[model samples]
Target: MASRRTALRPPLVSEPDLPDIVSPAAPRRSSDLRAAIIEVDGEADLAHSTLEQCVLSGSGSALDLDGATMMDVDVRDLRVAKVSARRSTLRRVRISGGRLGTLDLSDSGVHELELRDVRIDYLTLAGCKAVDVRVDSCRIAALDMPGATLSRVAFAATSSDEVDPRGMRAEHLDLRGLDALGFLDVTALRGATLTLRQVELLAPVFATAAGILISD
Candidate 1:
């Protein structure tokens, strides 16, 4: 072996491929579920699919199903300019966080019509029938659900300022945290009953809205 002088060795070179940079955020509903039909409820088995012409908002609300992730998976909100559910089935659907400029849920059936954490401007539910519905923590200026049969409807912490609740009916009306129920016609609650606290809270506003005077 020839006498090898200690020579300075060059550093070894290493190479690695780079990964494609993609957004960490989840895919959009229009893109991810383009072909997949999703249910509103958190169930293991889904029976319905193919929700064409349906719009789902991508925001979860406080009034949502328990133990369900409304933020990512509970994406069944329709942000359409005008919604026409003429012959659609929206059962067990947890819809929240969207603007339904005008909604016509007529003749359509709703098993669990959950509208939690939504921003509803004007909604019309004429001839629309639903059961077991809840609208909690929502802000609505006006909502019309006339001619619609509702069973066990609970509206908790919802605000319907300047809304017409005259003819609106609910089996168990939970208007505890509501601010305004004055814009509605008092005749609407003719056949319905209310609680003492609700009556007390609404008395002044009711009298004021009707141009009446309330004294001690």
Candidate 2:
């Protein structure tokens, strides 16, 4: 008798309830916002803030969200040049239909986060601890995860130019839906679950890492 394989667990995420009436205002630095819709026209400093049941929509040149705690927040149609979200705590957050440049979530704690239909120039999760994160229908130029710890992170219908996962630790990380051009450190993908085609494509990279040269 053969042993049965375990089923992969997808990210268990829940959508936030849409508010019927929301207060419209501009974002402030280090302020507590609840049940508000923020429209950013220019640069806004939202660092050290607490946002719950809020919607952030609009275009801006820069948005700073470092050291913030966000729960049940939705970011929709937000186009920003630079987004700094380092050292933050995010729970039940969803970002959709946005274009972001330089999204840095270093040293942060993320849970139940989902990003859909978004385009990002640079996304880094350095030194961060993340769980149940899913990226779907997104385009990312560069994804760097050095020194990061991720659990149950899955990517679906997502494409990336490069991915560097050096010194990263992951469990139940599904890479089947990710179309990545190359990986910087193949050895860092020990705990990930990849498809058969991905393994065939990465054979040469693994061979080079193991000092096994192939000649035709």
lDDT of 2 by residue, 1-216 (tens): 111254566778788666777898678888999999988787988999999899988888999999999999999988999999999999999999989988899999999999999999999999999999999999999999999998889999999999999999987788999999999999998778889999999999999999999999
Give the clash count for model 1.
5
Question: Number of the top candidate by TM-score?
Answer: 2
Superposed model 1: Cα runs more than 4 Å off: 1-78, 165-169, 181-183, 190-195, 204-216
Task: Kindly list the per-residue Cα lDDT of model 1 for residues 1-216, writing each as its tens digit.
Answer: 111242322212111111233222322322322223333322121112233223333322211221121111233454544444453455555666766555556556666566778777766665556666667788877777665555555566788766555445544334444556554565455333456777886677668767998787
Q: Please provide the root mean square deviation of candidate 1 (C-alpha atoms, Å).
A: 22.5
Clashes of each: 5, 0
What TM-score should be assigned to candidate 2?
0.95
